[model samples]
Target: MLNKSYQQRLEHDLEGWVKNGWVDRQNTGAILADAARGSSSTKIPAIIGILGAILLAAGVVLFVSANWQEISKLTRLLLLLAAMWFTFVVTVWLKRTSHDYLLEAILFLGAAIFGANIILIAQLYHIDNHYPDGLLFWAVGTLLITLFLRSRATLVLAFCLIVSWASIEILEFAQHPFWPFLPVWLIAAGLAYWLSFRFAIHLAFLSFMAWFFSSIDLLIKWSGFSDSETGGLIVLFLLTSFIYGLVMERKNSPLSLGFGDALAHYAISGLLLIVFFFQVETIEFDGWPATLPFVILAGFAAVLVLGTFIARSQKIFNLTDTALFLGFSTWFILSWFIPALNHLWLQAAIYLGLTIWLLIFGQKQYDKLLVILALIAFGCQVFYLYMETLGTLLDTSVFFLLGGVLLISLALGLEMLRRYLERTRDPQDSRSQEVAS
Candidate 1:
């Protein structure tokens, strides 16, 4: 499937070709129409179909629920099997008839039916094993279907089941790492590899991120810590290390797929967002996390950083990236000793600094989107800092007067800067294949 970046780039390139007179003006529409016809990644129709499928699945489930007492248990079991198989047969027929659009939605519906069958079957038999096992069964079954069909839609279905299963299992069973989750996630990743699906690979990346954060949450709890803030910092540091590995490895699909440096883009944006959320004061922690998890996670980060430095370091991830993360981790790590560094204002300051650095870096990289977002983040952090100050100094009217003026100027400046950057980074700047979009 063509990615959104490639889709937009293709449109831009087609226009450029027409302008250069390499293609006939009248033929441009036909060419683009042909391209659109071939591209399977178009979301609108698929999204609509998936929504319809969900509603259809829901209707079937609701119908079953509404008449459960009227039917025998055997009838209920057969009804579910028939519904699941009907969707699968439809998918196969769609494939054979070359109906690509509806094929995905049918496959999605089949997976949904199969998933519902797990629960319905359990209730029918009155079997009383751990119910998360039902979700686990659904996950494995959907994963197999995904692999067999090499369907991105079913891969998504599999991932949804995995996440739902983990959520239930973790919340029900106390901090049990849910270690079986690892193999299921790995299988999902393998499906991406098997099909060479770029979007599926991104789903894999997200799956890993969820598992990483959940595992860290459990680790913090096991170490006898309840402090949410400290755990956030630790997760950020470890995540940075993970991102470093992703950047250094430079994983990509086949050249035909046109997936370049997407991991780096996601990693960079992810780090910025993580740091930005750190300053939000709504979440409170009881106390600091135990030193053991912090030290162990830091050491794990050190090993990753060190390995990257050893293996063609600057070629992929550079010195500045290392230094920035080092500074970020050091701030919270030292808070354990100094305590003063843990102030909200100080956290906001560092996030502001990081925002500024990102703007400068994006300027150098010619990533207009990055610069625009960084400007927004910078303005937000400033506002957050001002609000924090207001909470303490509400008795002094003078502070609010000054803050009002500063905030108005900041807001106007941010809007102007973002619009200017967007105008400048238009069709000309988007000519690069590196994906300015």
Candidate 2:
């Protein structure tokens, strides 16, 4: 389902289209009415139903916990099985009755309870091989149910459980070449795509990124890849994904359905994250393999350049897009060569500048997702700069005071700059419109 805000905006646009004669009044009204119906339907009731189900599920668990010792082991086990069966039975009835919202809630609660059941059973049998093993079972079971019921809520839960189990196994147990999650993630990702669940796809992408970053260094060390090779591989992966997204965007591929917007964001974020690692590469300063980071920088520049040409060819290129590309590429490349950029203040400045660019671009394009990304980047940089610079200073209170003042000053300066840009750009925009007219 589309977000309420988006649906409302779409309805507004439809009404405008009617006035413009792009759509007939009758058709426009019909579409808007349908959108209103969709937007209003399922949201409030689903939310309330889901919340109630969660509370009821929790109550059941608490009740079980209170009487856990009173019941025999067999009885306890039987009760858990009964709960699982009962949930499924209720799910079937809900499906039969076409109560999809309540079904979703019940399915989610059932999946959660199933996880609890796994742990309980593990404890009952005194099975101890690693706690993640039980989680793995739980993930599989949840995924199976998710597939059977085609439930987005359960799909997300399955991904979370599986990703958590995989991360724990890899990080804590020194599990090498964690190949299992690749297939699991692929399956989950495929399912998400099939279901057109953008949120689930985002979670899957996040899970994949977590796995990649957590295991990349270890994978490189184990495979005897040098820093340059490791960097090259990472750069290649980022470029490939970005190019694939661009290709999909150009072609309007069905495969990109439900996630075209996210693909570009992921690509941009991957580049930004790579830039961040280079921004903090002090530990290995001795043998700093600048090759890969530089390659990534070059790749981004090339993409920006290529994209400019493509956009121009399509008559879609604009000043804002040019500025967005140049801003990020320049910041990324300059951060590498400028020794002064190593300072936390300078790093924060660069990040803040990028954040501002993203915000401006988002505003110009009316892309809410881009605005959200900008806010996230701003918050992250603020937190990082604070953490990195705060403890090193001798007088903590003074440091904080200075930091707060600096931030306030920067905010004011940025606002002034934004106003100046808007003022300057508006006249040029009006002139261009006059010329086009």
Deviation of model 2 at 372, angstroms: 5.9
Best by lDDT: 2
RMSD of each: 7.4, 6.8
Tens digits of per-residue lDDT, candidate 2, 1-437, equal 45778877887898888786669877866786677776756478887878887787687666555656767889888888888888889999998998877888888889878876776776677778888888888888888887888988789888988888898988888896798889888888888888889889889888988888888877777766555445544545554465456556666778887475677678767765775666666523223335654565466557656765565464443665565655555555444444554676666567676776667656765768768888887777766666766766665456558767876896798689889999999999889878977
Off by over 4 Å in 2: 1-15, 60-67, 174-177, 232-236, 246-250, 283-365, 371-437
lDDT digits (tens) for residues 1-437 of candidate 1: 34566668877898899886668889878877777777665657777888899899798777665656878878888988998999988988988897777888888889888877877877777778988888889889888888788778888888888888887877777546668888888888888777878788777778777777777766556556656545555545545544454444454335324334455456666665665665464445445545765676567667655645643354443576557756665664454445566677567657776676667656755768668778888888777667667756653345447656765786698779878988988756658634744
Candidate 2, residue 285: Cα displacement in angstroms equals 7.4
TM-score of each: 0.67, 0.69
Task: Write down the lDDT that model 2 would get.
Answer: 0.72
Window of ten residues with lowest summed lDDT in model 2? 283-292
